[model samples]
Target: MVKRCSWGTCNSDTRYPERIINVSFLPFPKPKTNYDACLRWIKACGRPVEQLNVNKITRDTYVCSKHFVGGFPSEKNPDPFPATGGQIYEARVKSRKRKYVELEHNSAEPSCSVPEVPCIDHVNPIILSRNENDKDTQTDEIVYTNLDLVAHNLSIKNLEEEKNALIKQNEDLKMQLASCVEQDFKLKSKRSPAKKHKQVVNNKKFSAETVANSNIKKLFEYYTGLTYVRFILLVNFLFPEEGINPVNYKEKRKEVKAMLLTDQLFLVLCRLRNGLHIKDLAYRFNIKPQSVSVIFKSVIHYMYLKLGYLSYWPHRDTIIQNMPQQYKQEFPTCLAIIDCTELKTEKPSSLKSQSQCYSDYKSSTTLKSLVVTDPRGSVIFVSDLFSGSISDNEICKESGFYKLLQQLKDQGYLQDNDGIMADKGFRIEKDLGELNLRLNIPPFASTATQMSSGDVALTRKIAAHRIHIERSINQIKNFKIVNRRIPGTLFYNINEIWTVCSLLTNFQDTLVKM
Candidate 1:
């Protein structure tokens, strides 16, 4: 039996035996008389007991004011157990440290009236102090247990799942990006074809009338003889040894007359005389531009080398033999009037090139050529083309015109009886004396004789006679080919054309004046 201590003012309790000492309690009846018997009862009941010593018990009454010994009254002396009634109660105060309490039965409920003892149940198992009041508690239930391990395992699993989900999402995003890139590439590749199709749909075609109006057709007529095939064939017959041949006529072939007529050649001559562009000729003939260019070059080359012979100056002996009787005594050995002229052209592209071809007269690029004509207005000599950058004096010097004069002198053509009439630019009066030739040029009026007199009158007469060559030059220029800008490809061909036209002019003069 357990009892509360009588030290209420002292604050001591018997059930909590460590809290008080020096308090007397009456001895209770022993359950078994001997220690062996007590041990047997303890084993049978399977109950816990507090430690006791036989030496601590007194003979008349073993008193422990702190606690009772058993749950029974003594059979040998049965008076109610009395507490020691001494004011000398020794009180013990409990420490502030936590104490544990055990319930007597599994179903026992806590009471509000009793002072509470705080208890902790750790999830992880731990050893607990035994309670004398608790007899049937299981030992397995007393251990503290850890609660965090299961929570930790679950968190690790969740983290692994989240990682897998993120990896799958990243792969899906990469696939989507790749698809977008592929689509962009395909779109770019398709653009060029679409643009090309649009261009085709928007393109315009040229019309028949517009083609007819193009200069290409005129080019054909100017180049193809228009009808000069017959004259070409005829001249070819006369100069068979000089690389001229009929288009198809051969020996043992009956002299088949040409299917084409001479009127065509005359028409071509008229066109050449007019100097129309090859493209314009092509337009008139309804032919291709290239065809006109080729035909014109071939026919012009043929006529220049073959039928164009009459334009050249007569040989020295021929001139001597054919000199007119009236002038034979005065100027018996005169050859021709020589002059230079400028033909304008389009400006060249480069600045240096522009300088090379520039002429102050037209203030643009030009071709320069020299012409020598007899008193009759027939061209006897012509020089190769030169840039307009050259002056008349430079041209005369570089063209070897003086050399030709020397040659004529050596041949007895420039005897004391002969004289040449030239413009003021010739300045050859003193130079002619060295070559045994005489120069006749118009003289400038002096300050004293500002009004013209005898010498001026004679100079005018000579100039009037020399003016025929200028007229011939004008006639030659009537052909637009010579008057207009010549293409660079046709440069060599233009020289030939010049010779041919000069010869034609002489021929026509002779025919018409005869």
Candidate 2:
């Protein structure tokens, strides 16, 4: 194989495994600059690089003359400066070191405190030595021009670098001094101010507004049994005057603080629909139980006012128009189906309340309501809760539905011929007949007789139609609070719970087609 010598100075085109006659081969060593210039010369002596076993050569690396026998280098022929092993070269370099040392010692005057001197015999360069020597300008000039010119240039270069570095450092120190002076001046000019502050965070750890954004969407239906859209609609319907109006509006009412209109509505619905304790709601809405109670009371009263109009028993004509085919065919002028629903609750500790609330029928302390739905299964009316101990006929009358019917009939909205369909549980036929209104009740078994086939068919038919009120009541009781044993905390305003739940059912998707 052909190989070109790596040295520009020794550009040989000889085949491998053959020696270059005059060049020396040295492996690149641990750093020493004295070996550098020697590697740059062409030579016709010594073993080839392959024999020296330098398998690879990088741009910065070298192998050259001073490592081999005939390639011994001297000061006069210092193109490839002598390697460290040469005794003659070492002596010459040592002599140059002493000369520079003497020059530095003699020149250590006031002007040259930061000394600038020739570098020679780099193994131990002549630094600022204290020993002085005779000053001879001619000798110094001869030594500098001939032997130490490179060393002289090197000294000048180092001195220039030091001088530039010192100048930069001085500029940095001046800048820092100016900045420090400015800071001191500003500090002295500024005056101290009075100490005062206002409360920023609310007293409650979580403000109502915070809870509404984070948990309301995720738990909207679970807590309220209403979607976000339905909840907002309910809020807008009930509390329109409480908020800023969009058109021809004035903000007279103090804007609700912290809690949003939606949050207030959602808060009440969660409690009523879930039958959750005020404290449980407090945790969910991130507020105290007292706040939950206050919000609950306010929302219930608000819903009563807003939703009471839905309980308006429709005129006989309106009912007839909206009645389903089954009712129209079987009992064409049937106004509505009526039933009583029971809500189990805590036994009141007070004798009076317990006596009033206890039901022999359910054998449990319970709340009851008169739930009414049109033939198409839409809730047209829900009475305020009554004691479960109250008889169905009494609840029917005392619920003021009888009075409402009487008023509507007197006002000519209800007709004498129009009637209500109910299960045999309601014995209001005679009472309603006194008002010249009919009550279509399914027949019950007498003591000694069996119901005829036709009578049984009629009862079954009426019972089938009665399922509408059953479904309507079921919907209201779907709120766990109404379905489960009541907590005493809500026993006081249990009427409001029944009223709100009953009214909310009407706002849901139409239960019966018109």
Candidate 3:
């Protein structure tokens, strides 16, 4: 076993013991046998406690002889204080005293005597004497010089001059700092009035223009569910002739407040995206809650009409071109993936209405809608809201999706061999077969207790590709207006709000990028 010094900066090791002369590695005192000594040794090593755990110390752990007094520890000096310039002098003094005592003991015979020199005050002397039967001792004294005192006084004078110079320099720096501070105060005072006026104007009003430019992207996305650029694009799209259309639009609705169209759009988007209450919006926009309600309804209606075409069904060529590779390989002819999503709503006061809206699937009152997306994750069609109690088959038939497909097929936008992928709950296989359209869904193990390997693989493949539709639905629900429980106050506009939110998600970046 090789011994290694545990001191942080030590390179002493038994492997190369010859490199360092007169150095010996000492084992750490066993904590069980000498706990206090072991702790002292560890502390003297100058290593962090975490790096040197006492319990983990093995026989190989060591501290080099250089760390102890007298080059190594001994009974005479058991402590392991590190050997330093100051400690070496103390050790030498103790050794000299011990040697003198030994010499006295060795000359114990009656004739063997050693003379001691007497110490005199105010004199430096060198005296050497040999004992001779108590003869008088002779001493040589050296006189002190005035030169030493003059040099000491000169050093003191020089230090005082240096200190005075540093004090003067510090005072100069302070004066310069004060002048700089005064100039800064004057500059700030000159700009304060203009800055104060601007702040007051900004604080007294809340509008789209008030948000800092650097934070527009994040803040607009938060409040509008769209970036600043996208929000501007949306604004331009909806109110094309902004100056003429918006004012006329507001006047036609008999809205009293002369608010900007951008502010109106911002208010509506905030209400929908953040789910903020009417009174909260009123306070924010500094308008009556009644005006807020009217603006929200009018803007939502205008948006619903303008953005309705966003979810129109695409041509077969376009769908095929944008389909992902995973779908291209397994579901090459797949046209659209369909899934149903439900939004929880407040309970109705009427027992009959409650019974109609209560869904066993969610164990709550919900309004369900069917969402359809192409293989590349663009929403193609979104069905009208249905009672939550309705089944997938009932909603599909009632949603006019099959009729729309037939119509698209008649217009050559769809073909006979194209497929529609859906969850197993849809149960629209026979219905699709009548229209010469293929139904791609997972297989059910109804025929036997378990499905065969081929059926299981088919189900796995279909389910894997079907997940994109779920992602599309998730993005639509990202709009908070349709995500949370719908308030009774907005129950009348829930359908339009839900439809508008579904269409708005298409304006976002494509879910499955090509």
The true-versus-predicted C-alpha distance at residue 289 of model 1, in Å, is 2.9
* lDDT for each residue of candidate 2 in 151-210, tens digit (9 for 90 to 100): 444446646766788899899999999999999877755622211111223223333334
Greater TM-score among 1 and 3 belongs to 3
Question: What TM-score number comes out for model 3?
Answer: 0.59
Q: How high is the CA lDDT of each candidate model?
A: 0.55, 0.65, 0.76
How high is each candidate's TM-score? 0.46, 0.55, 0.59
Ranking by lDDT: 3, 2, 1
lDDT of 3 at 251: 34
Put down candidate 1 lDDT per residue, 101-144, tens digits, no spaces.
Answer: 33333444322232222332633343454654663555423322
**Candidate achieving the largest TM-score:** 3
lDDT of 1: 0.55
Query: Model 2 — TM-score against the truth?
Result: 0.55
Per-residue lDDT over 169-215 for candidate 3, one digit per residue giving the tens place of the 0 to 100 score: 89999999999999999999988998888755643566666642544
